[model samples]
Target: MKAKVGMEVSWHLRMLLFISFASSFLNVSYAQTNNDYDTPAAPPPGLSNCNGVFLTYSFTSRDKEYPHIKNATAQAWAFKSSATIVNTGEYEVKAWQMFVGFQHKETLVSATGATIVDSDDFPVDASNGTTFAGGSQADLKTSIETAGDFTQISAQIDITGTQFGVKPPGVPMPSIIKLVNNGYKCPKATMRGSYNY
Candidate 1:
């Protein structure tokens, strides 16, 4: 009789533990699934609603290299990417500033055709967000009357981090890309298959 009671008590304890674990797991899953940034909301109405300026980001390659940080490992992944901003509007865009919302804990290595505003620090901490503006050719003219590459600005950027996904929808992308200019707005970025320029 005593043995039977002990067995029953042990079984009940095991069941209780299993239920607690399952509840915790379900709570974690629910929290992760309820992320608001998973699908960004549509841009607000009014104030230059037209999508005249287009931005495209391309993941070039990933390389493993030894970083020169203080307490870093012998190897780390470096990401190479490129972005293009084309102004197809009727008027010229002067001193264009763009906001980049990089989610990974990345440290910028190099960038061309633009510079981070208000920061001379190399390898800028772009983990949260940063702004990039034109360096020399700050004005992006309209493409309506342009013949060559006068209506666009292309940038090449490199960073080092240990984030996953190198291609397609799995690739790490900025949560938001907005034209910081007063009268211009930008839509969310879209993913595209690998293609050469």
Candidate 2:
């Protein structure tokens, strides 16, 4: 009876340990998943533009330590026509695009420099440069002034976080065009239509 009881107790202990581990693992996974893709309740309020560029990473609700930045990701877009810069309106439509992404940090993690990817050209006198980095930040004004003619500026917002030797996750395309309709200086800025990836 003692031996049988001991065996039964051992089996019960094993089962108990397994259940505990499973429960703990599930909880941890849930937490990690929650941390990965939490975005803002509403897109952060910014001055929307007609020919605008948006650089975003995956995971909005990130921890304080790493914040909203990840590794291994990309972005890209294209515009239909040119936007004239001769008016003084709140904002106008200057550019349109479809974006695709793999992985993006939910928040700003680091301010390290990234490779500039762009292909936009503006008139010398009426130029307001724009950067078209695949899925990263771009100096819009500087980019417009650099092109030789009307063209698309392409760039890669590379993530070089050494925390895990990983770049932000690869964000696929399909990120749509966002209008910068507010805080614009030109009244006649027209937005070209969008082209797909």
Choose the strongest candidate by lDDT.
Answer: 1
Give one digit per residue, the lDDT tens place, for model 2 in 1-197. Answer: 99999999999999999999999999989988895467533432232332444333322211123344443222221111211111112222243222222222221223223321233232111112222222232322323454422122322232222122223242222233222334433232122222211
What overall lDDT goes with each candidate model? Answer: 0.63, 0.31
Q: Pairs clashing in candidate 1?
A: none
**TM-score of every candidate relative to the true structure:** 0.58, 0.24
Error of 2 at 1 (Å): 4.0
Per-residue accuracy of model 1 over 1-197 as CA lDDT, tens digit each: 99999999999999999999999999999989997868753422221344476665555666645543343332345777665566756777788887777675666767787788847967677878778888776878775656535425233333333433332234556677677899864555555453211
**RMSD (CA, Å), each prediction:** 16.9, 17.9
Residue 171 miss distance in model 2 (angstroms): 34
Model 1 spans > 4 angstroms off? 1-51, 66-75, 148-170, 194-197
lDDT for model 2: 0.31
lDDT of 1 at 9: 100
* Model 1 residue 2 distance off true place after TM-score fit, in angstroms: 99
